[model samples]
Target: MRVYLPATFNSLTELNESGVIHARSGWAFAVTDALREFYTSGDEEELSDVAFDQAALASLRLLAVGDVEKFPHRRVVVSADVDDAHVTPVPDNGESVVRLEPAAVELDDVAAIHVDVPDAEEATAKAVTAIDAADLGDEDAELTVGDAQDNWLAFYDPSELPVLIELL
Candidate 1:
């Protein structure tokens, strides 16, 4: 099973030092029955985008839980393939959230990392702080967060991990 794990540059650094993304039960987004039903007409690409977007949202929540100064204000997501036996679906609002067991993902398991570009820094920072408000139907906050999401993030192949770490 392939899952998108939302993270931050700080978290990536931790992964670099420890050589693992550790968790007792890590949360990720995947294409599950609910996601398929929600995007009834979505093709493979569209469904994949949906999963990525969900991971991006999860990144914002992760950012909110920490001191903003700890990392660059950019959204980061690591895509990895895990064994199906290690993943279980969580019930969410018409979406798929997966809980991963044996959650210590080695760097070797990551296929790629997607990171917001420098251009997205400002808006992404705002979105990081506005997530809760946006969730509560705050139109202005929603716009701020939406603006951030509109920016495209760059993708790095797993082989470029060392260079990516230096850049971060």
Candidate 2:
């Protein structure tokens, strides 16, 4: 099974140093049965993209939590293929929600990572502050968050992990 997990540069550094990283929230996204049923029409790739988007949004929510000022304000999504047995669905917890347990995501499982480009830092910072409001249905706040979400990303192969840990 393929999973898109939310991450940050700090976490990437941890993975580099330890050869493994765990999602702090235990939540990851994937194209599950619920996701397929919810989408009226789309190919497998399109469905996967939706799961990826959810993971990106989840990354934003993490940035908005406590100690917000301390975290680097950028979004990251780690794409990996893990054994199907490792993933468990979160019932009625939205289409893509899943738990990855025993929670250790080893470096070997990583396929690639997608991260916000350097130019999007300002917008991402702004979005971090507004995510809570956006969640509460504030239109203006939603737009701020949307701008960050729409920012282009840079893709990196897992082999570049060392360089990415430093550059990000």
Candidate 3:
């Protein structure tokens, strides 16, 4: 199964150095039965995009919990192909979140990483700080957060992890 794991630049840097990501029942996004039912009109590609979007939102939550200054303001998510047996579906009221048992992934398991570009830094920084307020329906915070999303993340092959970490 392909799972999208939310991450930060700090985590990515660690993965680049150690060639591994150690997670504990990690919260991730995947195409689940519920997701399929919710987006009944969506084709496979569309459903996958929805799953990826959920991962991006989850990354924002991860950013909100961490020291914002310790890493770039951008959201990062790693996509990997793991055995279906390792991924367990998580029940959520809204989005499709999953749990990866023994959530440790070697670099070899990673397929790609999606991250915001340098130009997104300023808006992303604002979004990182405004996440809570935005969730509470603060209009200003919502705008800031929305702007950050406008700076769409770019995908990079797993082989580019080293260079990406250096840039971060």
Candidate 4:
């Protein structure tokens, strides 16, 4: 199973040091049946983008409640392939939601990461402030968050971050 786990910049530093990842949200995401139903016409890759977008929103949720001084405003999503047995569909939640144990994953298990870059911080911070309202079905708030997501994320292989960290 391929899972997209929400994370923060601080967690990435921890992964760099301790070599383990504890997803801030116990839930991860995937192209589940719920997602397929919600998005009736899309390829696997397109559905995967929906899943990744879900994780990015989860990341924003984390930032909204976390100590703002401690975590940077950027959102992070860790993409990894894990055993199917380790993943469980979350039907009660919205499309693409799933549950996965943090202990079952490690840095070495990751395939790639999608994160908002430095320039995204300002827009991301604005999105963070509106995520709660967005989740509550506010159309305006959803658009605010969606706008932030549509821009500024950079993709990286797990190996690229260590080198980019210093410069980023």
Model 4 steric clash pairs: none
- Model 1, residue 126: C-alpha shift (Å): 1.3
- Across 1-168, the per-residue lDDT of candidate 2 in tens digits comes to 999998877777778899997976788999999999999899999999899998898888777764333346878889989999999988588899999986889999999888888799899999989999998999999999999988866899999999876664
Question: Over 4 Å off in model 3, which ranges?
Answer: 68-70
TM-score for all models, in order of appearance: 0.91, 0.94, 0.90, 0.90
Number of the top lDDT candidate: 2
**What C-alpha lDDT does candidate 3 achieve relative to the native structure?**
0.81
Where does candidate 3 have its weakest 10-residue lDDT segment?
Answer: 64-73
Task: State which candidate, 1 or 4, has the greater lDDT.
Answer: 4
Please report how far candidate 1 places residue 58 from its true position, in Å: 1.0
Question: What is the overall TM-score of model 1 with all chains considered together?
Answer: 0.91
The candidate maximizing TM-score is 2
Question: How much lDDT does candidate 1 score?
Answer: 0.80
81-150, model 3: which lDDT tens digit per residue? 9898988787664557888887888899999999988888798888888989999999999899888877
| Candidate 2 deviation (Cα RMSD) | 1.6
Better of 1 and 2 by lDDT: 2
